[model samples]
Target: MYLADGLVPYTEVFSVLDWWKVAGTRYPTLRKVARDIFAIPVTTVASESAFSTSGRILSEHRSRLTPDMVEVLMCSQDWLRNKCKGEQIM
Candidate 1:
């Protein structure tokens, strides 16, 4: 049913998020998934930074760290950075 619907005019909506917010009630399941997917904050960091960070984190001395540990470290680093920025803003 969703795919059959006509495309929304760009003039009527500011963004995909806005469109979802308005039309979501008609498709409850899809809306839930879309909400979860869109809730993630977008990052502006360059791709090079990710490569360099991973390289440093997985250096020979740290190569034995499990994939789960690597994920935890990356998420923790990002959370800490965001927290510090929020503190600085005040």
Candidate 2:
């Protein structure tokens, strides 16, 4: 069994580590739940960024561009954006 120190409220502690150190002693299960939930990764915009760039590259007027050209343009864009140094993307 854990006992609350009552010295500090759990809500007052802003940091995960700080909360664990303070409220964890009083609510170990709740702490574990919070840890697990916090460990889960949030939605990422990285893939969306890539898609957005692709959309810009293949916009309405450029829709006539062939798939091969689109692929090449996208590859070049990615390579330049990432500063990649290697053989061209096939």
Candidate 3:
């Protein structure tokens, strides 16, 4: 049986995991799907931002870089950007 008739917006929160940790117990079946939903990338903003960086990396001056090298550079840039949690404009 559903615990609440409807879900209310939670306020005063920190992380997504924190919300799931508390609410999961109240709704096991829902929680299973909710965790997967939360696991998804959820947006293309990161990829778009990465493409912007890739453009910069492949400019005329650096065009001599080989295909494999280009791939490495692009992947490295994406990894570093994510590691730093840099902000990307939508």
Candidate 4:
């Protein structure tokens, strides 16, 4: 689903699609890609950014962390990124 030329034929991918929403388009290319070549269209890659921040928080020196400590750090990361409940951008 993630490769060059950006080709993902619809014949094998249909479990998670709603083609009825845009099934009728004037352009063949648009119609073909409407449900076929699915792409992540989030303008801002906040999720990726969050993960990168998390990695920076849990690197080498803090490698020997317990499960609970890891979870707490993950929560802290989400809060820092303003992605958790009651989160704020500071």
Per-residue C-alpha lDDT of model 4 across residues 1-90, encoded as one tens digit per residue: 123335435677674335444333434566566546555465566766756643455667777888798788777766766764565667
TM-score of each: 0.42, 0.35, 0.34, 0.26
The stretch of ten residues in a row with the least summed lDDT in candidate 1 is: 47-56
When 2 and 3 are scored with lDDT, the better candidate is 3
Task: List the pairs of residues colliding in candidate 3.
Answer: none
TM-score for predicted model 3 compared with the true structure:
0.34
Q: Is candidate 1 or 3 superior in TM-score? A: 1
Ranked candidates (lDDT, high to low): 1, 3, 2, 4
Runs with alpha carbons beyond 4 Å of true place in candidate 3: 3-17, 45-90
What's the TM for model 1? 0.42
- Native-to-model Cα distance after best TM-score fit, residue 33 in candidate 2, in Å: 0.9
lDDT scores in order: 0.76, 0.71, 0.74, 0.59
Q: How far in Å is the alpha carbon of 33 misplaced in model 3?
A: 0.4
Highest lDDT, which number? 1
Error of 2 at 65 (Å): 25
Model 4 scores worst on lDDT over the 10 consecutive residues at 1-10
Clash count, one per candidate: 0, 0, 0, 0
lDDT per residue as tens, model 1, 1-90: 788888876684378766767788887888988878878999987965764464568878888999999899887777767686785422
lDDT of 3 by residue, 1-90 (tens): 566557657787668677668778977999988778778875657765745663467778888999999889777777767777975534
